[model samples]
Target: MRTTFLVIVLLLMRNDAWSFVVYDDSKIWNQDSITFYFLDGTSQQKNEVKRFSQLWQRYTGIKFNFTNKKPSFFNFKKFYKISFKGKNNESTNGAINGLIQFGNLSDNIIFRKTTILHEFGHMLGLAHEHQRQDRPNYLDNKQLVTACMKNQQQSRAWCNENLFKKFYKKVFIQSEYDPNSIMHYDISNITSKDSETNSNIPESLNNSLSFTDKFYIAMLYNPKLDKKTLKKMHKQDIREQQQFEAKANAE
Candidate 1:
C-alpha cells in the first residue's frame, strides 16, 4: 500500500526536462539595440510582431531597432526571426504557446512572444519562475496527479511523493511568480484542459503603461523611465506575482 501511494505522488510532479526552447539570437540584443528578423510569409504575423515590438519597447525601456533584411543562415545571432510552419513545433494541448510553424515557416508569434520574454529572461540570467525558492504552493498537486494519469497513462496509484515535495517546493521565488506577468499563464488554463483561458485573464501591464495592450512597449523606450524608480517598479512586480499565485491557489 505504501508503494502504491508513492507511485501516485510521482505522477503529480511536472516534468523537469521541459523548458522554453531557445535559439541563438543574442548577437543583436544590446542595451541600445535589439533586432528582429521576420521570415517572409503572411503580413499578419509581421504586423503583430511589429506592434508587439513597439509595445515591448515601451515597457522594457529598450528599443528594438528591427529590420526585415535577410540574415546569414550561418549567423543567426544577428537578429530574432519569425517564420511559419506546416505544423505546430510544440505540444501544449492547443494552447497558443511554444515553438510554432506555419507552411515552411514555424514561427508562432504567440509562442514567439512568450519565447522572446523567456529567452530575454535567460539573457538577464533569471532562472525559471518555478525554480524560485520563495514561491507559494499555488498548484493543486492532486489535480496534477490526475492530469499525469490522464495524459501519460501513468497510474496515479503509484507516485513518488517525496521526490515532488522536495523538488517542487522551490519552483518559484519571491521575484518570479507573477501570474499576470506576461511570463505567467492563466492558472486554470495552464493546469486545466482549457485553451481559452485568455477570455477573462487580467492585464499583465501596470497602470502607468496601461494604454497599450503590450506593457513592454511603454516600459521600455520611455523618456520618463527614470521617474518610476527601480525599487518601486520591481517591488510591484513581485507583489503582483504573489497576488496572482494566491488567487490561483485559492481557486
Candidate 2:
C-alpha cells in the first residue's frame, strides 16, 4: 500500500496538481491595487512572488504592493496575508480574509513562479479553468474523482468533498474555456473514459499567461479597452512571447 500511495502522489504531482479553491463568499477586489504582507517566507521567496505577480499588473490595471510590516490592528478581514502554513498550495479567490500558502514549492524557483502566478490568479478573482462547468466534455470526471479518493495522503471523505467543491463546482463568470490558461491545472491523463475525442491535453505546463488570459484579465480590470484593440494587442503579445521563448531556447 505504501508503494501504491507513493505512485498516487507521484501521479498527482506530475499530472493534475491542484490549486486553491475559492470560498463561497469570496469577492473580487473593487480597488485598483492590492496590498500584501508576508507572514512567513524568506526575502528571496517574497521577491520571487512580487516579481511574478507584476505580470498580472502589466496586463490588468491591478497592482500588488508587498509590505514587510503587518497592519496595526488584527483585522485580516480587510488585508491580504500570505504564508507557508498549509500542506497544499492555495490562496483566497479574492481580497477576502484568507491566507495564501506556499506549500512544497518554497525552494523550487520555476515551480514557485508557476504556483505564485496560479495563486495570484485566484487572488484576482479567477477560478480554475478546468473547474468551469463546460469542462466535462474535455475531462473524465470518474477517473479524476477516483484518483483523488484513493490517495492515502488525504481522507476519502475529505477528498471527495473537496474535489467536488473545487473541480465539480461551476462558476458562470467565464464565458469560454481556456485549457492553456494559467488558472488551469496540469491534467494529462485524467480525462473521462467515454471521451470520444483526444482531448489533446497539453503535455507542457503553462509557465506564463496565455493570450486569452491576458485578454480576459484586461476585460475584467480594464473594461474600457475595446475588444478589437485587445485582440490585436493579444496577437502582438503572442508574437513577442514566441520570440522570447525561441531566444531563451537558443541560449
Candidate 3:
C-alpha cells in the first residue's frame, strides 16, 4: 500500500494499512504460516521487507516464511508471492494465492516500514478505509480525475474505479471508518478539498495498526478459534447485517 519507490518520483498516492477490514472469510488466510517467494531484491532490501513485515505477524499470530525460489509454471502457486522491484507497492488481498508487488526500498528509509506493513494489510485482505461506502464524500471527483490523468497517466475510468470507488459495507466489516487506518491515502496533496474549512488529510503518516486493526486480526487468526468458530462468526455477521439493513429500510 505504501509506495516509497513510487511516491518520490511518480507522485503516486499510496494507501496505508488497517482500519475498515474486508470481512470476507474466504479471503482470510486460515493457515498459521504464509510463504513468500521474492523474484527480485538484494539481501538488505529483502531483509528490510522481512523485518518490517513482521509487524503484521506480531499482531495476527501469523508467521511468514521467506524464499527466493525461481518460480516455474509448476510451482507458481506455492508462495503468497512478492516482487520488490516495481514502481508501486501492491499485494494480493487475503488468504488467496497471489503476488505482492512490493516497491523498492533502497532509498526511502522513512516510508519503508510503513509501505511494508500497509501492503501486508492488503496481503491480509484489508480494504482501504478511505473507500468505504460509509465514509462521507471527501475527494473532489473532477479535481482527482484531472490529477490522476495528468500526473499518473491513468485513464479517467481507471482513476474513478481505483481512486474513487466506494465499497458498499453489505459484507462483514469488523471495524469502523478510521481515517487513521493504514489502508488510507493522504489525499490532501492529490485532490482539491470539497470545502475551504475541511481537509481530508490524516492525522499522521501512520506507521502502525489502530486498536481495531489488532482486535479484528486477532479475532480472525486467533489460535483458539477453530475453522468452525470462524464460520459461525462470519454467519453471525451476515445475519446482523441483514437485520440492520432491514431495520433501516423500514424506518
Candidate 4:
C-alpha cells in the first residue's frame, strides 16, 4: 500500500498540469500558528524537520507546533500531516491541505538541513525556481531533458516529452529565476545556457536560503508591503539574481 502511494506521488510529481491544480493560493495557511503531525520518521528526523520549521519561522511571521499524537477531530484540520514514504520528497503547495510526503534524509546533518529547507519552501507555496517563465533564457531544454533522463534512468523519449512536461514546465509567478534559492534544483551539469556562457553552468543546491530567498519570503508573508512595492522588489530581485548567475558563470 505504501509502495502504491509512492508510485502515485511519483506520477503526480511528473505531471506539471497536476502541479497547477495543487498550487492554489486559497490553500495557504492564514493563521499565525500551525501544527504538524508526523505519521512516520525517526525522532531525529522529526526533530530536524521541526528545527528547520523554526528556522523558517524566524524569517517569516508564521509559527509551528509539533505533535506526537494526532490532534483530536476538532483540531485535525488545523494540523499538517507529514509522512515519510515516497522515494522523492514532495509537499502540498500550501497549508490548507496539510499533507507532506518526504523521502529518506541523509545521515549527514548538512544534507538533511538542505533537503528539509527545500521541502519547506514548497510548503510555503514556492515552486521550483527552474520552472520560472524566464528560465528558458538561462537553460537549454534539450540539455535539461538529457539530464532528467540520466537522473531518473528514463528513456530519451520519455525525458524529452513527459519528464520535461512534468518538471520543466513554465510557471507564472511574481518572482525571478533565483538559482541560489533553496527552491532551485542542482542543475549544474544539466544546464546548457546562462548569461555568461553555455558550458560549465554553475551548480547551486543551497544549504540555506539565499538573499533573494529571504527577501521574497518576507515579501510574501508581510502584510505591510503593498502589491506594487512587491512587484518592484521582485524586479530588483531578478536583476540581482541575473548578476549573481553571471558572476558565478564567469568564475
Candidate 5:
C-alpha cells in the first residue's frame, strides 16, 4: 500500500502542466520558451523540477518545454535539476526543501515544493538576503551571526550589491529583500531574550516559497538560454552545490 501511494505521488511529479497561484502585483512578461530536462531521480526530485518549471512559466509568461530524460553524467550541469535523499542528516529532519547547492537537510516528507523553488532562486543568482550587511538591525542573535559567518556564501552575508544588475536587461522590483518570502528562513535554534522583539521572525523554521519566488523566475524565463544569465546563475549553483556536498561529507 505504501509502495502504491509512492508510485501515485511520483506520477504526479512527472507531469509537465501543474497549477499554483500567482500573488504578485505585476503579470509576468514571459518572453521565451524554457525547457526542463528531468534526470532519473525520485518522485520528490522530479516534482521539485516540475514545480519550479510551472512557477517559472506562470511568473515569466514563458512557455516551458519539458522532458524526463534518463540519468546522464552531465545532464544536471546541462539543465536545471533537483535531487533528493531519504536521510539528510546535515540539517532539520522533515525540514522539507532547501536550495541544492546552498544546503541539504535530512529529507523526510515531500517538501519537494519548497526545495525546488529555493534552489531555483540560487539558479536565478539571488544570494541569501539574511546575510545582507544592512540586516544587523533585523537580526539580533549572535549565534545566527556566527552561523552565518561560518557559512558566508550560503548565508549571503556578503555579496556584491550589483550582482543582479550584471545579468538582467531590465531590473524589476524582485530586487528588494523580503523577510516574509517563502525563500526566507525564520529564527532557527537561536533564541532571543525578548521573544516579543525577535518574534517578528517566524517561530518555526520555514522553507515554503512565496510570491517573490514565482515572480523573478518568471522574469528571467528565457527559452533560448541567455549565455550570460545562464552562466551567472549556473556559477552560483555549482558553488553552492559544492558547499552542501562538502558540509554533508564532513558530517
Candidate 6:
C-alpha cells in the first residue's frame, strides 16, 4: 500500500556571469546530494533505513546524511532537507522537509529491505512505475483499490490518492517498465484489463533494485547522463507532472 506523487519546484543555478540556470525537474531532486534526519524512531528502524539507503548512493552518487543537532529557525532556509517521521510506510518527493515515514518495520528481512528501497525511491524522486500511462493494460484497477483498502487498512479515498491514480501526459510518453522494479507492486490476483493476463503479472517482490532502476537513477542524478539525454527525460517527466497541472486548468 505504498504510493508517491511528484512535487514541483524550481532549482535555479547560475554561472560566473550570474545568469539563472534552470533545473526545474519536478520528478527528480533539485540537487544530487540531500540530507535527512529522523525526528524520532527506534534505533532498529533508523538502522534499517540507513542500511538500505546505501543502494541509491552507490548507484546514483546521491548522498543522504542525517544529523542530531537542530538549526536555528531564524536562518531562513531556501531549500529544505527531509526529516523522516511518522509510523506509516509512506514517502514524499521533493526538497521539502518531513517526507518519509517508516511504518513499523516488519520482521521479514526481505520485506523490510523492500520497504526501505521503495520508500527511498520516492525520496530520491521516483513515482510509481505501475502508474505510468503507457503501462500495459493488465492491471485490475478496481481490484487494486479494493485490495489496498482491505490489506493496507486504507480508505478508498486514500487508496485512490496513493495507488489508483494515473500519472501521465496525454501528449508525451516515455517509459522503462520493469515489473521487478522496487517502485512496483506484486499483485497475484487476476488481471482485469487486456487479454494479456498472466503474461504481464509483475514478478513477486524482491529485495534488490531492478537493473533498470539503477541505470536510470544513475542517469538522472549522476554525471554520466548528458544534457541532451537528461533534458529529454526531464521534459517528458515535466510534461507528465508539471504541465499536467497547466493542462488541467484549461479543461
lDDT of 5 at 168: 20
Candidate 5 lDDT over 1-251, as tens digits, reads: 32343344345442332121111212222224434455346665565566544644444454645567643565333343333443321221111222233134325322444455554544444444454433435464544554443433333332222111112222223245556454454544323334343555555334444444444443344323444654565466446545745665576
Q: Write the per-residue lDDT of candidate 2 for residues 191-223, one digit (tens) a residue.
A: 333432334444534767877787766655666
Give the alpha carbon lDDT tens digit for every residue of 1-251 in model 3.
12232133123221332224774546766566788888887798789789877757866676888989854567533357778766667787777778888664425453566678788899888887677766656553556666655655667886687677776544443356776566776554334344332344444445456555655665556545455665655466446535744664576
Q: lDDT score of model 5? A: 0.41
After superposing candidate 3, which stretches have Cα over 4 Å from the reference?
Answer: 1-20, 71-78, 104-106, 148-155, 189-204, 223-251
Q: Each prediction's Cα lDDT score?
A: 0.38, 0.63, 0.63, 0.61, 0.41, 0.57
What is the Cα-based TM-score of model 1? 0.44
Worst 10 residues of 6 by lDDT: 1-10
Model 1 C-alpha lDDT per residue in residues 1-251, reported as the tens digit of each score: 32343244335534442222111212113344445555565677566546534434544555554456875667533334445544322221111112223332224334454544433333322333332333345432446555444543445553223111223232111122444444333334333444242334343432111222122222222434444554455567457546744664576
Candidate 3 C-alpha error for residue 212, in Å: 2.3
Per-residue lDDT tens digits for candidate 4, residues 18-93, read 2221244444556667787888888877887887666568555687778878768776455577887776567777
lDDT of 6 by residue, 1-251 (tens): 01121121111212222111112244456554566656666677777678767877866666777654464466443233333455567776644554677755666655677778887887666767666655667664466676666666768897787667766432111334567677876554212333233455555544567656765665455646555765565455435434544554456
Residue 40 lDDT in model 3?
81
Model 5, residue 104: what's the lDDT? 48
Candidate 6 lDDT score relative to the true structure: 0.57
Over 4 Å off in model 5, which ranges? 1-31, 64-78, 85-110, 136-140, 145-176, 189-207, 212-251
Worst 10 residues of 3 by lDDT: 1-10
The estimated TM-scores of all candidates read 0.44, 0.69, 0.69, 0.67, 0.44, 0.67
